[model samples]
Each structure stands twice: as C-alpha cells, then as structure tokens.
Target: MGFHTFDIDRADALEDESRYRHLSAEELLAVLRPHPEMTVADLGSGTGFYTDDVAPHVGHLYAVDVQEAMHDIYREKGFPETVETVVADVASLPFDDGALDAAFSTMTYHEFAGEASLAELSRVLRPGGRFVVVDWTATGAGTAGPPTDERYSVGEAASALENAGFSVDRAESRTETFLCVASV
Candidate 1:
C-alpha cells in the first residue's frame, strides 16, 4: 500500500461507539458546523462510521474511500439518503473546483496526508470552506491508532495545509490525537 490503509475485515470495529473516545460526533459537528444546506465530503470514510454521524446534518455528503469494499460494508449497514458513496483517493477527487461547502476526515488524515492530497482538497473546497481533520498524532503513546512513526504531528499537518493554500484556523493536540481546522 502507498499508505497505511484500513482493512475491510475490521470494518465492524469502526462502527463501535467506543471509537468516538478519540474524537466524538459532537466535536466533529462543532468544528465542521455542518448545516442542512451544506454539501460536504467525508474523506477516507471507512465503513461510513463517522459518515453516518455527519450525513444527517449536512444537505449532502460524499463518502469517499479508496477501497470499494469499505463502501460495500457501509452499504450493508445502510446509510442516510444524504450520503453518496465515492471510491477515490484524496489526491485525485472527482469534483469540480470549489465543489464542496465543507469537508472533514476522522482518524484518516495520516493515510492521505501529502502535498498532492492536501492541494486537491484545497482545490475542491470553495473559498472560506472549512476542512476539519482529526487523526492520531505522532506524539501519541501508541495506545490507539497507528504507530507513532507512521503518524504526523499537528505542526506537520498544519504546515502541509498551509503549503497547499489553506489558512489553519485552529490546531491543537490531544493525548493521542490532533485536531486541525483549515479553511480554503
């Protein structure tokens, strides 16, 4: 794999509520501020775990995952009508320029963090569009998520977003994770 991808065999684990201990639905919505009129995309939407949380709040959601099998798992679980399955990489999305009103990723940033992917996100989001990222931090103790060596720090993510033409509004580190809010 080019990056650390989630295994579809463990798709059931993603639906567990305990997974929210790192980043809750409340916190994600608070930062994403998804509205009934907003069109959003959930990048690296594994099994639509978090996608199911945000779909109801947004007018539309594109559940993007590199693995089609993940989407199949989500389909079996049933998702909101607002949710649309999209199989694509973050580096290359099938959307027009400024197509999304807002976008977010949960525990998936490390899998897609790069200049090309970040720049693609910047290209797809409208001006002033918000992009919230919650992922395992490199500074973590390895209790949850990927190994420290495989993760990126908040500073690194912030810098990459900035290099991709995003203005980071908020960047903070939690015990084992980081939250970064960047605007296009």
Candidate 2:
C-alpha cells in the first residue's frame, strides 16, 4: 500500500488535467497510420500530450521520459520540429538497434513493472516496427485504477508483449482503455 509519490510538479500536474484529456489525439492518429517518414517513440511521454500531436506526424519523436519535470514540460511548451525530449527509462530505453519506426504508450502501460516494461518494449522496436499499447482496463478489482497493484490487464498486456519478443497484434479492449498492436 505505498509507492505513490510523484514530484515533477505533481507529475506535470497529472499531465495537465484529466490525464491528458483521456486520449483521442485524433483517435491515436487513426491508429497510427503514420508515415511522413516515420520514427516515432513515446514511451511514457507525459505532459507533451502525445508528443505534440505525435510531432506533426512523425519524422522523428522520442519523447521518452524519466521526467526531468517531463523535460520541463517540453521546454515550457514550445515543441515543433519533430521533438526530442529524452529523459528516458520506461524500464530502460535509449534507442537504436533497428532504431524505431513506431512505438507508443498512452495511459503509460499501467505504470510498468511487467517483465521490465516488456523488455523495454522489446528493445526499441523496428524489426517490423509497431507497438501501440495503451492501458487501464481491468474494470473492477480497483477498477482499472492505479495503486491497485499498479493496475494492468488486456490479458496482462498481451501476455507481457508475447513474452517480450512481441508479435501479438490487435488486442482492443477499448472504451475504458486497453488497446494494442505489436510487431518486432
């Protein structure tokens, strides 16, 4: 019954109200049909609200976050040129290997702890590239609310992203949230 202690200005003020206004950044960019040149990544990227609308449809993004006050709230709200605010550690992700072409996390993966953020989302994606994964949906038993063992579901996050190699796609338990897409 503990470990609820946030600071980065109250977690960037609970991500500027209603937890970043309960997703729908144009329906997660229409389920990430993104491809303006692709290079996304947003693991726990708070306060920037889906990295400023996924940084004008991705040619770069990497808003990662351990929270240097959420990169000073994306440098006091001035983001534009394909973003780059990395404080990182969604259980350890820096980048490069296949070097991301897609990645995401809304509702921040139930505050992670499963297989170390699914092995850092299978080591920064890009074998096939795509890993959407939104969270919060256990309905009852604390009702998808955090602090109930840091909540998680969607079949335990798609079986912890298919045991961390990730190839399990499409898992939508949506509405109160739990969407998925994976590959790598």
Candidate 3:
C-alpha cells in the first residue's frame, strides 16, 4: 500500500510554480514526448497543474483523480479543450483496455504505488506506450514533498514496473526526486 492521500485543502500548493524546481514542465515534456494524435492520462491529477502542461500536446488528456473535489478545483482553473476530468483511482481506472497511448504521473506515485495500480496502468496503455513517473525519492533529504519513509527509490519503482511487464527505459534519481520512464 502507499502513503496517505493528500489533503484537499492543500490543493492550492499543487499549483505553485516553485514546484518546478523539483519537476519542471519542460523536463516532463521531454520525457513524455507527447504527439498531437496520442491520448494520455495524468494519473492522480490534482488541480490540473502539470496536466495543463501536457494537454496542448496530446489529442486527448484525462485528468484522473480519486477526489472529485480536486476536479472541482481544476474546473474553476479552466480546463483546456482536450482535457477531460475523470474521477477515478489509479488502481481501478474507467478506461478501456489499451485505450490510452500513454500516461504520466507527477509527484503522485508514492500515493498509488502497488501491484494493482501498476497492473491497471499496463492494462490501459497500448503496446509500446510510455508511462512516466516523477516523485519524491526515498533517498532524498526530508525537506520537500513526502517523507523519505513514505517514498520509493528509483530502483524500487523500476523493479515494480518491470515486474508489471513494463520495459523500463529510464530511471534517474535527482537530489529530491526520481524520474522513471517505462513502456508497455
């Protein structure tokens, strides 16, 4: 199981630009490599922060979150034409099998890391589709994001994806975060 869910009251913090210092939009876009015709999902999307960054690049973007209140907050922020809000958990998405061309999660992996969640990700993504994850690392200093004990190291995440039948192409650990790119 993962850590506790984020507090809905702190949803505003998710929109802070300073968060880019940990995971920038440019860096996420570079790894995501979204094409105009591809369909993508922003898993655990809160307030559509990073989701907005990827929306313009994809044909369809699903801002998926377990909390409908978060979706309400995103709606107030103005959703893009291509972005659709889906109230669903990562372990049990409403998408069809192989419906998505790709999927990405920003700083929410620790909250949803488990066998069921990873398997569902593999099921929804098309063959050769990418799954990008950027989250606080267990090896990091306890200064930002979740506590170290509640996080996963890059190696643990990579191994979990591999065990879920994904081919990990990139796994890098930075000062406070880890980025992992895998393909179904």
CA shift of 159, model 3, Å: 0.3
Native-to-model Cα distance after best TM-score fit, residue 5 in candidate 2, in Å: 16
Better of 1 and 3 by lDDT: 3
Backbone clash pairs for candidate 2 read: none
Model 1 residue 4 lDDT?
Answer: 72
For each candidate, the alpha-carbon lDDT, in order, equals 0.93, 0.73, 0.94
Off by over 4 Å in 2: 1-9, 13-37, 41-44, 48-58, 62-72, 75-80, 84-100, 110-127, 132-145, 153-155, 159-166, 169-181
> What is the Å distance of residue 71 in model 2 from its true position?
11
Task: List candidate 3 stretches off by more than 4 Å.
Answer: none
**Cα lDDT, model 3, residue 99:** 98
In model 3, pairs of residues that clash are none
For model 2, how does the per-residue alpha-carbon lDDT over 65-100 read when each residue is reduced to its tens digit? 776776786788778888888876667787766788
Candidate with the larger lDDT of 1 and 2: 1
Alpha-carbon lDDT of model 3: 0.94
Error of 1 at 166 (Å): 0.5
Return the number of clashes found in candidate 1.
Answer: 0
Superposition error at 167 for model 2 (Å): 1.5
Candidate 2, after superposition: displacement of residue 40 in Å?
Answer: 1.1
lDDT of 1 by residue, 77-110 (tens): 8999999999999999999999999999999999
